[model samples]
Target: MNIREYRAFFLDTLSKAYDAAEAESLFYICLEELKGWKKVDLAMNSNAELDRVELVKWNEVLTQLEQERPIQYIFGNAHFYGLEFFVDENTLIPRPETEELVEWIINENKGKKDIKILDIGTGSGCIAITLAKNLPQAKVYAIDVSKDALAKARGNAVRNEADVTFIEKDILVADSLPESFDVIVSNPPYVRNLEKQEIKNNVLQYEPHLALFVDDNDPLLFYRKIAKLGDRSLTGNGKIYFEINQYLGPQTVTMLQEEGYKNVILKKDIYGNDRMVSCDV
Candidate 1:
């Protein structure tokens, strides 16, 4: 069948799972990745026929989408801070809110010299790689507990041509860092089990759970441990940043203050939800 015919079928098949507008968007994204055809190309070549192999690939993607697999996972790539990184079942797809966190860090320390930055739980190394690429003088390091995740993160650092040191260590059990850092940042697992209903099925089903969830009884498990680590590892003027759960913003800020951090500040994302916090050592 031709492009136009297949487009109609794709939208209709996805209608039950996604709204018309979202279905349209997903259809175009799939077409661009699977066949290198954009909207204008589709408009100009509406009658262009799909060969048997191409049709089969499209059908497979359609099946996956119906199964609620993320499109980024299907294509094995996701864009973050203007760079594309490889993603799979091993890593969580990068989100736009996390881009804001990256931007906030870059804005605060754009031209510093010889600064060291550490990203804890750097599942895909999105934060560390972006910092290295944007701040050429800064030394960036990333840590993740999962070897599979770290392997992909290392590959991403090479793909982006951003020099970063990837370490395999679990922060909860570690007593000290390898060295001090001017800045420490994390977007760790903050979603509580009680809030699982708020998460979309595609995320809850397809993304790595170890990277998405925390215990409902102690949701700040990572924050508490990382804060303790920062207390010992931060340079005298070092600052720490976190992308937090909106529901626990005030609690996170209070925890930092109790840990003796100064200038504790909670900031909101574009959606105006309290999503980020920062403080000094």
Candidate 2:
């Protein structure tokens, strides 16, 4: 089939699942891989064609996208903070809101030197690698419970050329964390079981639930453990950063305050969701 015809087919199939703009976006992303054609190629040559074998491979990709499979997973690559990271079923896809948290950490420690940072639940190593790349003067360590997830994170750190120490451990089962940290940041599983309805089908079907969910009865389970750990782990004037659940921002802030963390602040993502919280000892 020709480029134009294949584009039409791709758009029609994905439009049923996504909005017109999103569908078109996905369509061109497919063309870039299938035909090595840029967006301008579609506009410049509407009648480009493909061989039968090429069409078959393209068909498989479109079939997955039609099934609400994430494009990043299909491509095995995702961009975060202007760098590309490998992604797959083993790791959660990096999101833009998390980029904001990374940016905040970079901004918060722009001129600081020789500090230590720990990233709890560092799925895909997005936060840890970004911090390590930006703050070369700091020691960055990341821990995740899932070996599969840690494998992906370690690969990403190498690809990004960031120096990060990846540890395989479950924070929930641990009694205490290592001390002497100047900053601790985490974007742990905050989505309650009751909040599953709010998640889109693509995520619910394809993303790793271990990195996305928490107990319904105690939604703040991970946060409480991390907060208590931070209280014990951080040095004087050490800061803590969390990407929190929008539904429980106030409670999260209150919990941090009760843990003796001062200057607690809750902030929203670009989408206006209550997404980030910061506090210091």
Candidate 3:
């Protein structure tokens, strides 16, 4: 089938499961991947035909999409901060909000020299590596409890050519970091287990539970642990940054303040929900 006909069929098939816009975008992404053609090429060469092999591959991707599989997982790579990183079930797919958190850190510490940055629960090493890449003079270190996650993070460091030290250590453990850092940041597992029902099935079912859930009774477990660690591991005038649960923003800031982190600030996201918190040590 030609590109135009296949795109229409693909969209029609997926529209039953997803909205028109998402379905169209998914179809176009697959087309670009399989045919090595961009949207401009599609517009100019609508008559371009797909060979038998290409058609089979396209159909396979379509089948996966119909089953609600994420296109990023299907492609095995995702774009973040203008860089591509490999992704899989071992790590959570990096989100745009997390990118915003990175931006906040970069902008807040733009001209600082020899800044020591530590990223706790650095899945795919996106935050740590992005900071390292953007701030070349900074020392970046990342830690994750799961070795599988750390392995992927290490690979991402190499892939991005960012010098990030990946360590396999649980952040909840008190004696993890041997030395202090200038900035500590994390996008830890803050989703309370009870909130599973509120999340889309595509995420709750497909994403790694280890990287997503915290006990409802102690939803702040990771936050508290990281806060204590940050207090112990930060240099004088150092800062702590967290991507927090919107529902628990004030509580999170209060927790950090009680732990002796001063100047606790809660920053709202684009949706006007409390999303990020930063504290000075």
Give the Cα lDDT of each candidate: 0.95, 0.90, 0.88
- Candidate 3 Cα misplacement greater than 4 A, ranges: none
User: Ranking under lDDT, best-scoring first?
Assistant: 1, 2, 3
Against the hidden reference, what TM-scores do the models get? 0.99, 0.97, 0.97
83-162: candidate 3 lDDT, tens digit per residue: 98989988899998898899999999989998999999998899999999999989998888888888888888899999
Model 3 scores a TM of 0.97
Candidate 2 runs further than 4 Å off: none
lDDT of 1 by residue, 70-101 (tens): 99999999999999899999999999999999
Clashing pairs in 2: 1-50, 2-49, 3-48
Enumerate clash totals for all models, in the order shown.
0, 3, 0
List model 2 lDDT by residue over 129-165, tens digit each.
9999999999999999989889999999889999998
The segments of candidate 1 whose C-alpha lies over 4 angstroms from its true place after superposition are none
Best candidate according to TM-score: 1
Give candidate 1's whole-model lDDT: 0.95
Q: Quick one: best lDDT, which candidate? A: 1
Backbone clash pairs for candidate 1 read none
lDDT computed for candidate 3:
0.88
Give residue 241's error in model 2 in angstroms: 0.2
Q: In angstroms, give how far residue 87 of model 1 lies from its true place.
A: 0.4
TM-score of 1: 0.99
